[model samples]
Each structure stands twice: as structure tokens, then as C-alpha cells.
Target: MKDAWIPYATRAVPRYTSYPTAADFTPETGVAAAMAWSAATRADEAISAYLHIPFCDKLCWYCGCATSVPNGYRRVAEYVGLLLKEVSLRGRAMGPHGGIGHLHFGGGSPNILNPNDFLELMDALQRHFGLRTGAEIAVELDPRTMKPGQVPTFARAGVNRVSLGVQTLAEDVQHAINRIQPRDMVVALIEDLRGAGIDAVNMDLMYGLPYQTTQHVVEAARFAAEMGAARVSVFGYAHVPWFAKHQRAIDENALAGLHERFTQARVAAMTLEGAGYVAIGLDHYARADDTLAIAAREGRLHRNFQGYTDDPCETLIGMGATAISQFREGFSQNLKDRKAWGEAVTAGHLPAERGIALTPDDRLRARALETLMCRLEVDAAEICAEMDVPDDRLDGALDAARELERVGLCHVSGTVVTVPEEARIMLRTVAQCFDARSPAAAPQRHAKAV
Candidate 1:
């Protein structure tokens, strides 16, 4: 990595999974806004739903997800009941949408739910939201903690996609991260999921972890390819112990330095590409025949809270503690505290704790940012025209891009801004130029751009 790029790589920027990112959410625009937005959905449009399961059998030290070890099943069962009630409440609040076109189960670990409870939750989702025919049901799994019958149960429940948390294959790296699943364990689980007819497996790999090397990253990526993973996401470990408490367990001194982290990311990319996977976006690689790759090729790809997706629904309803929902009006998040979330649902209220209402400017900037992040380039004039805003409305952002251009981070050709292939890893930084809500310098609040 060039020394000139170090400053940009170390800067923090919103991932732009959503414009006016979660940092802009507040209590002033909470449940009432979420309800209004839900009620305003077009009846003819299909919607998507996300159910979060915030419990894990064991907490991994490096994990940043909102999850805890519920030593007993009691808390898990209670949460599931509350989640179902919340789902019903949200269903009644929504406009007469066509149906749920995509249903995603994410978590600390969605597989934490008892097999029967998981089934019941699925039934409730279908009953209340009307799961559209051929809807894709996707779940994120922790292969280390997945219960014996869970894979078969998921298959029986019509789950078409399963994402496994296989962060690394190196035993030492796994030990450093406090997640010690062997490569063979993940391989066996992949086989089990495929044998049960759920073949769309996505693997999550990590680089820049405590004591991780470029070779470790390469080996992990190769393992994903060998396991026939449809998609592989190589994420750089964000050491934010102050934010994610459990992350404090990680020894900061053992972590890869900035340049090492950058190299690891590049090595992972090369390894996945060498294994016949097409790079979809900054961090995701998909098999040449995978839907995600196809989506990217055709410009139908989308970035959401779940990272990258092919789902094109205009509305996304999120349920469970700390889950975030996206609507045309704005974004809403369920209460992060379990008790508060449960109480709200029990009281027949949407659990939205904080959110942001989108302004016309917010929408315009959001589209430009998404275009740049997803496509690695954006025609500023074209985006402004599509949003029905005057081209000059984005003059400030274009000016910001000019600075990046001078640094060789991106190119600004009139109203078009493009990140060169060499600067793809810094794509978030380029996208940040258009983020009006982000402060000029707020590195403490977000992960490094690299």
C-alpha cells in the first residue's frame, strides 16, 4: 500500500449500507415514524423481512454483533415469543403489500433457537406476512454451535440459503479470536446443508484479526472455494473494543498493523478470484454462476444492513432486539435492550427505539452513494437527474471527490466520480464524500475505511 493512501485507509467512513446511516437515528423519529412509513408502503410492491435472533451459545471475543450467551433456553424461548408478537404487530401496521419476497434470519446466531421454536417462528412469519410463493428464506448460522437437527430442520422449513460463520481456518488465529472451530467442522456442516438440499451456502471469512497473516486469509478463502460456497465475504476485522465490549478480550497488540491489514485484504481477494469466484463488491466474492455475481453483472445488486443482496424489495421490515428496518421514508431500529423490546411488543407497540426520517436531499445523496459503492462509479449528473434534483445540488460532493482524485483515490470526470481499480478497497472513502451527515473527522465512531 502507498504511504499516501495510508491516511485515507485509516480514516473512518460510513459503510453506506444505508445513507443517513444508523448514526443519524434518534428517539425523535422513533416508532411513530416507523409506523407511518410502514403504513405508507405501496400495496402492489413486494417487501422483505429480517428476523434477528440475538442469542449465542458462546460469545466469541471478536464478535461485534448484538448477541449474548443465554446459558439456558428460557430467555431464548421468551425472546422468540416476543419476536412473534412483534411480527404480528408489524404485519397489521403495514400497508397491503403484495407479500414478503425475501425473508432473512440473522443474528448472534439464528441457529440458537430450538428446532421446534425455529419452525414455529417460520410458520408465524408466513401466516402473518404472507410469504410470497418462491420467496427466498435465508439464515446465518454458526457452524460451531449449530444443533444436530437444525440443518435438516432448516431444509424442511424451505430455507434456500444458509450463511456459515467460518471466519478463519488457522487454529492459532481462531484461538486468538476465541472461536476455535476446525476447518473440517465447517466442511462437514457444508456437506450436511448441501445433502439436505440447501446448496446456496455463503461463508464469512475475516482478515486483520489478532495474529492473522495473509497466508491465513488465503487458506481460508481457498477453503470456502473447496467447500463449494456460493458466496464468500472477506471482512477486515474492526478492532472496536470500546464499542463491542467482548472485543476487549482481544489483545490489541497482537492485531495486524495498517499495512499488514491492507495486504491481507488484497491476498484474500486474489485467492478468491484465483479460485474462480467473481468479486461482487469491495468484500464479497461469488461463484461465477451465483445469483449475486449475476446480479452484479446486470447492475441489479443492492447493499443493505445484511451487506450485499439480490433482493429488490423497496421495503424491509426488521424484527427483534436491535434489528433495523428500511423503508422509503427512512430507517427504524427495534429497541436494543431485550427487556425493552419485549415490553414494547407485549404492549402492542412496534419496538422502534430510534430512526431517521429521510429528506429529499437524503434520498438524492443516498442514491449517489449506493451507486458509487455498488458499481465503483457514479455519474453525479445522472443520479441527480434521476432524483429530480438540480445537478448543482451535488456540487459540494463533487468538489470533495476532486480532493480524492488529486490523491489518486478516485477520478472525477466532470459530473462523474469513479474509483480506480487500484483504489477499490477504499471505495467507502470515496462514497463518504457524498455523505452529508457524516462529520468531517469522526474516526472514533466507525471502523477504518480499509
Candidate 2:
């Protein structure tokens, strides 16, 4: 019904979930910076935590997450052991923080670990940082690999939310992506999680996969609402075979074109918003009463490694291989190699391998990008005035906005830039206007924005 609005929203750009996106992270900045930032968390300040479980039971062709298929439980178990050790190591480095207000488990599939291992992991985390009284503990699950008793493991670990990766319910599409699961199976898993007291369920849906169409995307959106998903994230499939090797398995010829991808995303937005879900950012939607909805309505929504979130804690301590931690001053990322990470932790050193220290310019651009991403508008003059930045310093970004405005994607007043409501899908392109990285450096670096 809203087909006329599709053509204007498909431009590709960085999600701006972070300024100087992950593509900008390099080896020049290392563990020392991360440790210092972690140690800097005031004893009375609560922090957010993220743990990466990079092992998956099966590899989906469309997945771009940092994960690999472990041949057996031994590899995963080994990773878990190292994760726990890093947990303790980072805990020591953090000294005494107030407590963790938000704890998130993400990856290839967090549910792949055995129930007991999962519980012990949570216990180890609590012992280290100490969890806040009403903190939010969230995990991303692969319903296809979920075990019978794992739901209880999540509930017992005090997980208040579970995000199930149900990319699509169409059998053929699932088969094409190598992540098949019947619709009934997903519904059952939702019911099971709810019965186990994990009432907050977020379902991940996608379009532009091999053989996907706007019709399929709409169908999936309606089904998600029918299943009572509190939140649904509709992501346009980003095809980057050279980067994500498994993606090569996806037939490029069958993948939807950029315009079609745009329609699919728009269809999802229209369907979910029609179903009473509030669109929170470029890709996430939540029910009216959801915390994300509250965050958006109150202008408290935040963008993070996990995309749109409600967590306001400034320090984000990341654990496990290749995990990235954020602090007020900078970011630190753990080594991607399991053996190397474990060895570093065993040696009583943080396993961080690379990072970036945020410069004042980086911070300013970051705030500007976040404002545009979350609120769809930015008062450049006002923000610069508040930050004591010279107005002329943003001339380059203004020039970029002029180019976008010529195309009718955004409007620029004397000191403000506002992305039109219908052009929100192109918000990333607008956000990229402030990126300080060279074009050659970032173009080859990230997935297409569509």
C-alpha cells in the first residue's frame, strides 16, 4: 500500500551504531587503553556488559556475525573456559565497580553451550562485577540449536529477555540460507521461553536473502505479530561474500536487488507499525509498552554494538574472544584467536589485541551521528555550541549534507539537518556525512547500507 515510498530509502551506509564504525578499529591501539578505561569506571558507577560466544552449532550462509561452527563440544568447551578466565581477568582489572546494570550474551548462538556450562558462566559473571538489583540480562538464541532444558538455564541465570534468530519462516528461504526451522518450531520455542518466565521475546527477521521477496517479508512480519513477539528487528540482508565466506554459499543471482531490498524493508516497517509496533531505529521495532519504545519516546534510546538499546551505562565491558568493550574515553577489542586470548588471560594480562582512543573530534562526530540516528535530526549549531566546537569545523559534514539535500533525502536549515520521515531508511547515509575516515578506507570496509 505504501509502495510509492520505496524508491527513496535504499541507499547504503554505515549503521552509525558507533562512530568510526568497527571498520576503523585497528591494532595501533591495544590492551593498555582498554585496561585503563575499564579501571576508570568509578566505584559507584554501574556499567553494561557484553559477552561473545563465537561458536555456533550450524553456520548460516547469510550470517555476518563473528562465529564459527565447532566440530565438537570440545572446541566450544575450550572457548567457554577461556571466556570464564577472561571474565575473572577483566573483573580484576575493573577493580570495584558499583554493579552491572545490563548484561548481554550475543554471538553465533549462545544457546549452543550445555545448560550447566551456561549457568556456571553466569555465576562467574555475577561473582566478578556483581549484578545490579534489577539489571536486564539478555541472550540471543538460535531456536534450531536450542536444547530442551536450556530455556530454564536462561530463566535461572536471571535472563529477563531472549532474542531468537528466526530470520524467516519460509521453508525454501530457510533452506537456501542453510538455517531451516519450521514455523511451528519457532512458535513452540516462543511459548516455551514465556512459560519459563522469559516474557520479553525479540525475534530477528530479515529480507533480501536468496529468493526472498517483499511478500515474504510482509508475511514474516504479520506472523511475528501474531506470535506475540514484543520486539521484531527486520534487517536487510547485506551480501558481502568476500568478507563473510559462508555468504558465498548464497546465490547472488537469487538475491533481491537494492530497490527490492528497499521495498522489503519498507514493507516490514509498514506492517509492523500497522500492527502497533513502534519503529525504534533504522531496523528495530518494539511494542508500545516495551522498554525500547519507552526509550525512544523519552529520547533515551541508545545505539551500541547490539544496535538499538535502552542501556544508558557509559562503560561497556566485553568478554570472550573478539569481543569489543567501550569506555568513556576509548574502545578495546579482545584477540580473535582462541589460543592467543587464553594465553594472554593466563598470563594475567587483558586479552585485548586492538582498539581506538576516541579523540575530541571523534567524540563530537559520534554524538552528532548518534543524534541523527536516534532522533532523525541534528541541530549542528546547537550541538557545536554546547561542545565548544568551532562552527567552521563541521564544514565538511555540511558539504555532505548539501549533496544529500540535493537528492531530497534530507533538509538542512542554517544549523540543523533533518532526515525526512520517509527517508529514514537512508539515515545511515546521512550519518556517514560526519565520518572522518577516508572514502577508500571505509568503502571496502563495511557491508552495503541497504
Candidate 3:
């Protein structure tokens, strides 16, 4: 890594997964906004739904997800009931849509539910939302907590894709993060899922762990390839103890330094690319034939709260606590507190507690940011024209990009701004230039750009 880039890489920046970001959400735009947005969905357009299961058997120290350990099944069962009711309410609020084209189950771990309970939830989703024929159902799983018969049950329920949380293979690093699934365990789970006919496997690998080395990161990427993972996401472990209390259990001193973290990221990227996985966006790698790779190749890729996806649904309805829903109007989040979320749903209301209404400018900037983040380049003039706004509306952003250009972070040619291949890792910094709502100075509020 160049010393000149260190200052840029170390600075905090929005991931730009969503323009205006979650930082802009507030109580002023709550349930009413969410209700209106859902009600306003065009009947002819297919939509996406996200179900968040915020319960896990074990809390990994390095996890930043909104999940907790349920000492007993009663809590999970109770939560599932509320989740189903919430689904019904949201479905009714949405009125009639083309049907659900994409369904996603995420969490602390969706596998935490009992197999029967999991199937019931899936049934409820289909019953209420009218799951479109041949729609994609994707779920995130923790191999450590995967019970017997779960794989078969998931296949029976029509789950087509499974993302496994296989953050690291090193025993020392796993122990440090309080997640100790062996490499063999993960490999066996993958084989079992494939045997049951759910072959679209996505493995998640991490780089900046408490005791992770560049070799550890590289070996993990290699293992994912060897397992025939359809996609692999290499993420830098964010150490935000204040945001995720469980992360405080990790020793900060044991984490890799900035340069080491940068090297580990590069090594993992090289390993995945060398293994024939096409790099998709910032941190995702996919086999050349995978849908995500195809999306990137054809420019159909999209970024959402769930990271990169090929789902083209315009409306993403998020169910359960802390899940964020994206609509044409803006973004809405269910209450983060489980009790509050349950109460709202029990009262026959949407659980949305805070959100932001997207202004025309917000939409325009979002399009430009999404374009740059997904394609590594954006034609500002084209975006403005597409948004039916004058090209001068983006002059401020283009000027900002010009400043970054002088630093070798990006190139500004006419109304087009492109992040160079070498500066791809700093993509967020370049995208941040177009964010009108970003705070001037609050490094602690976001993860470093790298």
C-alpha cells in the first residue's frame, strides 16, 4: 500500500450500500411513511422480501449483526409467531404486487429456528406474499449451529441458495472470535447441502481478525474455491465495540495493523481471482458462470442492505427487528429493540421506527453512488439526464471527484468519474464525494474506507 493512500484508507466513510445511508434515518419519517410506501407499490411490479431472524445459539465476539443467544427455544418460537403476523400485516399493507420475486432470510443466523418452525415461517411468507413461481429463496446459515435434518428441510421449503458464515479456518483466530467451527465441519455442511440439492453455496471469509495473517486469509479463500462455493465474500472485520457490544470481547491489540489489513485484503483478492472467481464489486467474488458474475458482466448488479445482489425488485420489504426495507420513496427500518418491534406488530402496525424520505436530489445522488459502487465508474451527466435534471446539478460532486483525481484516487474525464483499478479498495471514498448529507467530520461514526 502506498503511504500517500494510507490517510485516505484510514478515514471513515459510508459503505454507500445505500445513499443517504442509515445515518440519515430519523423518527420524523416512521411508520406512516413506511405504510404509504408499501401501499404505493405498483401492482404490476415484483418485490423482494427480507426476513431477519435475530436469534443465534452462540454470540460470536466479532459479529456485528443484530442477534442474540436465546437460552431456550421458547423465545425463538415466540419471535417466529410475531414474525409471521408481521408478514401478514406487511403483505396486506403492500396490497397487490406482481408477487415476490426474491425472498431472503438473514440474521444472527436463520438456522437458529427449529426445522419445523423454519418451514412454518417459509409457508407464512408464501401464503401472505404470494411467492412467485421459480422465485429465489436465499438463507444465511451458521454451520456450527446447523441441526440434523435442517438441510433437507430447507430444500423441502424451496430454499435455492445458502450463505454460510465461515469467517476463518484458523483455529486460533476462530477461538479469538469465539466461533470455533472446524474447517471439516464447514466442508461437510457444504457437501450435505449439495447432496440435498441446494447447490448454490456462498461462503463468507474475513481478513482483519484478531489473530489473522495474510496466509490465513489466502488459505480461507482457497478453501472456499476448493469447496466449489458459487460465491465468496471477503470482508474486513470491523472492530466497532461501541456499536456491537459483543465485539468488545475481542482484544483490539491482537488485530492486524492498517498495512497488514491492506495486505491481507489484497492477498485474499489475488487468491480468489487466481482460483477463477471473477471479482464482483468491492469484496465479492463469484465463479464466472454464477448469477452475480453474470449480473456484473451485464450491468444488472445491485447494492442493498444485504450487500450486493442480482435481485432487480424495486421494493425490498424487510420483516423482523432491525431489518431495513427499501422503497421507491425511501428506506424504513423496523424497531431495533425486539420488544418494541413485537409490540408494534401486535398492535397491527408496521414496526418501522425510523427512516428517511428520499428527495429528488437524494434519488439522483443515490443513482450516481450506486452506479459508481457497482460499476467502479459513473457518468455524472448521464445520471443527471436519466434523472431528468440539469447536468449542473452534479457539478459540485464532479468537482469533488476532480480533487480526488489529483491524488490518484480517481479519474474525472468530462462528466464521467472513474475509480482506477488500483484504487478500487478506496471506492467508498470516491462515492462519498457525491453524498450531500454526509457529515463533514465524524470518523467514529463509520468504519474506515479500507
- C-alpha lDDT score of every prediction, in listed order: 0.90, 0.85, 0.91
lDDT tens readout by residue for model 1, 130-161: 88899999999998888879988999999999
Error of 2 at 252 (Å): 0.9
Q: How displaced is residue 290 in candidate 1, in Å? A: 0.9
In angstroms, the error of model 3 at 443 is 1.8
Model 3 clashing residue pairs (backbone): none
lDDT per residue (tens digit) for residues 1-450 in model 2? 134434333334576767777777889889878877878888888999999999898899999989999999999988888788888988988956889999999997999999989998889988988999999999999988888788887888899999989888887998999988999888999889889999999999999999988888999999999887888998888888888988999999999877787788899999999999998868899999999999999999889888998888889998988888989988888898878988998888899998888999998888888888888888887778778989777777878888778877789998788988777777787777778873323454666666
**How well does each candidate superpose onto the true structure, as a TM-score?**
0.98, 0.96, 0.98
Provide the lowest-lDDT 10-residue window in model 1. Answer: 439-448
Clashes of each: 0, 2, 0
| Candidate 3 wrongly placed segments (more than 4 Å) | 439-441
Cα-lDDT of candidate 3: 0.91
> After superposition, which runs of candidate 2 have C-alpha atoms over 4 Å from their true positions?
1-12, 438-441
Among these predicted structures, which one has the highest lDDT?
3
